[model samples]
Target: MALLDKLTSGSSTPPDTSGMSKQAKLVCELVADFNSNNLLTQIRNNNRSKSDIDKTYKYPDHFTSELIETKNFKMELLKWKNSHNPYVVLQFHGGGYVGAFKTQYRMFAGLYSELGKGASVLSIDYRVAPENPYPAALNDALYAYDWLLNHGYSENHIILAGDSAGGGLAMALCHYLTDRDRILPAGIVAMSPWTDLTASGSSYTENFEIDPLFGNTNESLIYNSVYPGNHDLTDPYISPLFGDFTGFPPMLIQVGSNEMLLSDSILVAEKAKSQGVKVRLSIYENMFHVFQMGMTLMPESKKAWVEVSKFLEQMMVL
Candidate 1:
């Protein structure tokens, strides 16, 4: 209750961290060390060369990722061996539009498959920013969706999912499809989606200290500078917080109550609900930025996926 008060108070300060779980506390400490060591700065500085980052985050042997290359872009399909699942999940990995490493994306796909029992996830490695920039990633997402459709999956059988920038990208893709009269997916699941590139949300300042991953406004500034080029931040295709969700399918938006992007999820749900869209917003108590990444250890993270599975199951049947 205190956490909710802090979130809705619109105060640009963080709440007490005394109630955080042991795992969450450890993650907060680890991320603090990570930031103090300037690891994120190094990653952003490395640009398109992921060799160093790749070495740091490799997928386990159990996960299978098949490489798919197109003339224009590339993606990976992650699932169990000989999976016959008819449903598919097209996932966009989050790295502030600057990072889309396979390790993180593959892990997410693996978790989805495990949770859904048989569904497979296609993680799209779209062109990143400060190099390919906007529309490049968006176009690649659309292309990957088309590739899935061409491979025999129907629009209703597919689900769009992502975190952070990728979550924003997923929303943008829905808008793009809706605008072009293309068939939409059955549902969407976004984890801590950065819907507003402008960083206008009150949570940006309110939950700053509690959010372990995002330290300050500089991270957003760096991502915004490289991503948008000369485009306005308010453009719905870029910052989906302003997009039209009138024709959008049912969406499940999850965010940590302690993260700065909390407002992004709240407002997006409000906006979608206003348009008569089915939107379910889950705000986890005491969780931080993309805390679901702690699925291997955190109980809250595991609970989050359970909720996701329930949502997917309910939506896919409709």
Candidate 2:
């Protein structure tokens, strides 16, 4: 059951720099600088001034940023393209559930659209912690999903996907939908999903030195704190690894062998399999969290996208 010792056994290849537009390279550098300077942390800590902060930052293309109001709360939605039977992909972005914008995932939205054959993707900008506590983000995601269904999209045509925290949300949404007696989506894809908000997975220690995105246990604890309130982190709807996998749809999980969340994905896959849910897991060696974002430059990223596309095609035929 422990898959952590199985290394990728592959060589490290640089991302494809030739195909990258000058603007993209510039954006990557800027983001790298911002991350290095810990500006992202500053933004999250100062959530009270988000409006001014949002106005100062520039987002990438392929995502039209805007806000949507639901009965419970207001959240943002990132629209990729307009298409009939659009094969909608509801995306949740990763920022430890505290920071990160929809535009930061432009590469994913573009690749999903291209690989999914014109799928119109919408990345959810749910409420974050300290300001919005447990179930706030979950409620917003469910509301958006319901909006999509009401607007003519069938559950069978939708694909739930996300990276890091968003990946966890995808799994949580699946569990939530099933609980509501609603039809599940066509499929689900989680890239290094942070399934255990309690940070209780073994990889949190085993892969600590190997993971570059999250360096150590201390950092993981800080990220987990974003979720305010006394809710149980192990609640199946909160930490999907604890959720019932029975009656769930097919799933695809991709994670880096070096990520702290590696065990989280592995455990989810194991639980799904035990519950009779079809699951496919791809573990990329020497890769970091959400490494697929480098698809514009990384061969492995492209290959991962191809695998996801194949899974979606198979789900469509069912």
Candidate lDDT scores, in order, read 0.78, 0.69
Best by TM-score: 1
Q: Per-residue lDDT for 1-318 in model 2, tens only?
A: 011111112443433423544544454455445544566746645653243213333334434546555565444444543534357777777766665454446556655655565566766667777678778778877887888898778888888888887888888888898888889988888888888877778988888765655664375432456574788888876788889999988889998777778889999999999999999998876566787776534555655666777776776643
Off by over 4 Å in 1: 1-18, 43-64, 217-224
TM-score of 1: 0.86
Q: Across residues 1-318, which tens digit of lDDT does each residue of candidate 1 receive? A: 221222234433333333677887888788767665666657655653351222344444545667787876667776656667688889988878877554656667877766555677888778877778887889999999999999999999999999988899999999999999999999999999989988888887898766666756455442345788889989999999998999898999999888888999999999999999999998888788788787645556656776787787786653
The whole-model C-alpha lDDT of candidate 1 against the native structure comes to 0.78
lDDT of 1 at 4: 20
Number of backbone collisions per candidate, in order? Answer: 0, 2
The lowest-lDDT stretch of 10 consecutive residues in candidate 1 is: 1-10
Q: What's the C-alpha lDDT at position 95 in model 2?
A: 65
Q: Over all chains combined, what TM-score does candidate 2 have?
A: 0.78
